[model samples]
Structures are given as C-alpha cells and as structure tokens.
Target: MESDKMIKPTVSYHLFLYREELARRNARQLRLSRTKIDITEELISRTVKNIKTCSMDDLKAVNRELVFKRKLRNRVSKLRKEAKLAKQ
Candidate 1:
C-alpha cells in the first residue's frame, strides 16, 4: 500500500511535467509560425509595390528595366551572402 501511494504521486508529477513541456513546445511553434507568416506578408507587399511601380513602356525599355532589377537583386544577394559568411 505504501509503495502504491508513492508510485501514484511519482506518476502524477511526471504527467504534470510532460504537460508543461508540451505546452512550452506548442507556444514556441506558434511563435515561429507567426514569424514566418509575417515575413511572407512583407515579401508579398514588397513584390506588389514593385509590380505597381514598373512602367509598361516600349519592349526595349521593359527589357532594360528587368535587366537592371536583376543586376541589383544579384548584388544585394551577394552582399547578404558576404555578410552571413563574415558572421560565421
């Protein structure tokens, strides 16, 4: 009877710990999901703004504009890569 009493409290303690740990993990996942959603929204907003601003002129001009944007994006990506490497 004494061992049974001791085992019951031990099991209850472990169950409580397990519940707490699961709750913590769930909260962390929720925060990460929210962050990803926020980033996605920001990217969409920026893309929409760029599309709205792009002029639809002559084909040559449009091509030139696209090339320029591509070059600029490549440069930015290179810079980001360099910065990340430096941090490492």
Candidate 2:
C-alpha cells in the first residue's frame, strides 16, 4: 500500500516536469515565429522602396534619351536643307 502511494506522487512529479518543458518549447517557437514575421515585413518595405527608386531612375534616363534624340533629329534636318541649297 505504501509503495502504491509513492508511485502516484512520483508519476505526478514527472507529469509536472513534462508540462513545464512543453510550455518552454511552445514559448520558444512563438518567439521564432514573431521574429520571422518582423524580418519579412522589413524586407518587403525595403524592396518596395528600392523598386520605386529604380523606376524613377529609369524614367529620368528615358526622358534624357528622348531629348537627346529630338535635338539630333533637328540638327540632321537643318544639315539636309543646307546640302540641298548647296546643290542648287
């Protein structure tokens, strides 16, 4: 009867330890999940900012090229008129 009583207490103690360990594991997992979400949000913000900056740079480059081409076309037309007058 004494041994049976001791067995119950021992089993309860082991169960308590198991519960504590599971709680710690769950807390650790929660922390890791939170960190992953934070990092992902930061990365997304940075990527969006980079894309906006790159798009602005691309627009500026295209505008500059268009202006340069227009000036080149005007110069070519003037030169062609001069050549025609010379031939006459």
Candidate 3:
C-alpha cells in the first residue's frame, strides 16, 4: 500500500513534469537556433580569401570574432549539459 501510494503521481506532479519537459525542449531549441549559422563552401572560401587579403587590424577583428563564437558555443554546450542533467 505504501509503495502504491508513492508510485501514483498526482495532477500537480504531472504538471510539474510537463513543465520540466517543456523547459528542456525550449533550451534545446534555443541552442539550435542560436548556433544555426549556414557555413557553406562559398562562405569558407570567402573567409579564406579575406584572411589572405585583409589588413592586420581586420585579421585581429576576425580573430576576436572567432574567439567570441567559440566562447558562445562553449557556453551553450555547458547550458545544454546542465539542462540535460537537470532533467535527470
């Protein structure tokens, strides 16, 4: 009887679970949306050309942008992991 009581989930408990699932899905979607840059071959070629032809200051700016994107990716990955663990 005690086990049965513990095993049965209430309406509020169901709602909480639904909310948690929604939050997880939202986090996953946010990560996808934020990182969805279409890096085609043309873009890569353009970047290579820019690197070869750009001034030192332009190269530095590009380096900074790359670093910023790296950090953002890391942060998003961390957040996604945290969200995954939280679901458990």
Highest-lDDT candidate: 3
CA shift of 53, model 3, Å: 1.6
Worst 10 residues of 2 by lDDT: 28-37
In model 1, the worst 10-residue window by lDDT is: 28-37
lDDT of 3 by residue, 1-88 (tens): 9897688554455455545656783545443423332122223335668686778876666566666666656776777788789899
The per-model lDDT (C-alpha) reads 0.50, 0.51, 0.55
Per-residue lDDT tens digits for candidate 2, residues 1-88, read 9887665434335455445655784543333333333343434444556665667665565456556555555665666677689799
How should the candidates be ordered by lDDT, best one leading?
Answer: 3, 2, 1
Per-model TM values vs. the true structure: 0.35, 0.38, 0.48
Can you tell me which runs of candidate 3 are displaced by over 4 Å?
1-29, 36-45
Q: Tens digit of lDDT per residue, candidate 1, span 1-88?
A: 8886665334335455545656783543333333333343444444456775655653445455456555555665666677689799
What TM-score would you give candidate 1 relative to the actual structure? 0.35
Instruction: Give the Cα-based TM-score of candidate 2 against the true structure.
Output: 0.38
User: What are the clash counts of all predictions, listed in order?
Assistant: 0, 0, 0
Worst 10 residues of 3 by lDDT: 33-42
